[model samples]
Target: MNTLAHGFADGPGPGPWILFVPLMWALVVGGGLFLLRRAGWRGRAPWQQGRAALGEQSPIVVLGRRFAAGEID
Candidate 1:
């Protein structure tokens, strides 16, 4: 009684390996975005007092000075 009606056709196909391709792509893209953000750290960060020569204050410090000058309150 070798019948295809009740045979291997009912068995499960390949398993979780099919999910790896998109997972790898997502990891690669996420790491790329992280590095891109990290690369901009120098430009966005304020120059420290120890590092500044001409006395370049950070954006936050500049804002504080303006506030002290009655710009905000």
Candidate 2:
């Protein structure tokens, strides 16, 4: 019987490819998290920032703009 017919009979066990799967998964998850964070998924989004900036305006300023735009009397 040829020992080579059976894998790892006398040769080295597994190669570095054994760790590639988990490493790829870790990279995929980590990259996704990084993208989410960069896209402001964890904090205020761009639209929210615009709203916050508008909100920061003084009430009188908002009223003046509304009156100028004829939104209110």
Candidate 3:
């Protein structure tokens, strides 16, 4: 008999292996983000990098440069 069919027929499958999905997702995603940032991928690439490179600059930095340039009061 197929063990998977029997298990699901019983209910909820079985052991804690269900938790592996989220764990694996976190490992893949978090590890990728960490590696990207560590390698200075932030604000460097257009597609391969993350949000820090997407031209989403903070207001403070923009304002600072504007003030220095006498563009704003």
Candidate 4:
């Protein structure tokens, strides 16, 4: 009975080795980041300061609309 069932079914396939694909990728990415950090690579370029300063009002279009709607301080 068991021997007949084995003939008609798929065998247990590719065990845990398939998991190594993502594992290797994770290690590679982690290693690259580690090397970059050791080599003084700070990830992204610093953002340039924008022309707008803190505590500034919105553009004239927005201010005009707000004043017309009585929504401004």
Candidate 5:
């Protein structure tokens, strides 16, 4: 019976380098997401910046704008 055929081989199965492939992919995807979010945040118009920073406006403020625009009686 041949030793190689009988499952007596002596060599490294996968080695530590195989782990780097998924790690590199995760870093690349995470970095791309971070850059996209940063770009989107910076791309907002100047007028929109204050509203975004302040979160949702109050209902009274919304009514005031509508009244000022003559959209409300």
Candidate 6:
């Protein structure tokens, strides 16, 4: 019989080893996210980065807002 009651009538199959799939996936995803954060991904928004890169005098930003407001073509 299956140790964790997860097999069929043909005796035990993978038993509890099937749980390793999810555990391994969790570790992989969590590790990837942690490494990404350590590599300088502090979750800053796109607009924040754009403003910091171009400063307050950027014409593209003003033009983008004007386009959104339909002020000019």
Of candidate 3, the 10-residue stretch with the lowest lDDT total is 1-10
Model 6 spans > 4 angstroms off: 1-10, 50-73
Q: Please, what is the TM-score per model? A: 0.39, 0.45, 0.41, 0.42, 0.40, 0.46
Q: Which regions of candidate 1 are displaced past 4 Å?
A: 1-12, 41-73
Give the per-residue lDDT digits (tens) of candidate 2, residues 1-73.
Answer: 5343344555564554567679999999999999998886867655555655666485767899999999999
lDDT of 4 by residue, 1-73 (tens): 3443243345644555566778999999999999988977776553323325522444765788788899996
Instruction: List candidate 4 stretches off by more than 4 Å.
Output: 1-10, 44-73
Global Cα lDDT for candidate 1? 0.66
Mind giving the per-residue lDDT tens digits that candidate 6 earns over 1-73?
Answer: 2365565556657766688889999999999999988987779975666676776578887888899999998
Error of 1 at 16 (Å): 0.2
Q: List the candidate numbers ranked by lDDT, top first.
A: 6, 2, 5, 3, 1, 4
RMSD of each: 8.8, 6.3, 9.4, 11.9, 8.2, 7.2
Per-model tally of clashing residue pairs: 0, 0, 0, 0, 0, 0
* Candidate 2 deviant stretches above 4 angstroms: 1-12, 43-73
lDDT values for all models = 0.66, 0.72, 0.70, 0.65, 0.70, 0.79
lDDT of 1 by residue, 1-73 (tens): 4343333554554345556778999999999888977877444445453445545565667888899899887
Stretches off by above 4 angstroms in model 3 are 1-12, 44-73
- In model 5, the worst 10-residue window by lDDT is 1-10
Best by lDDT: 6
**Residue 60 lDDT in model 3?**
64
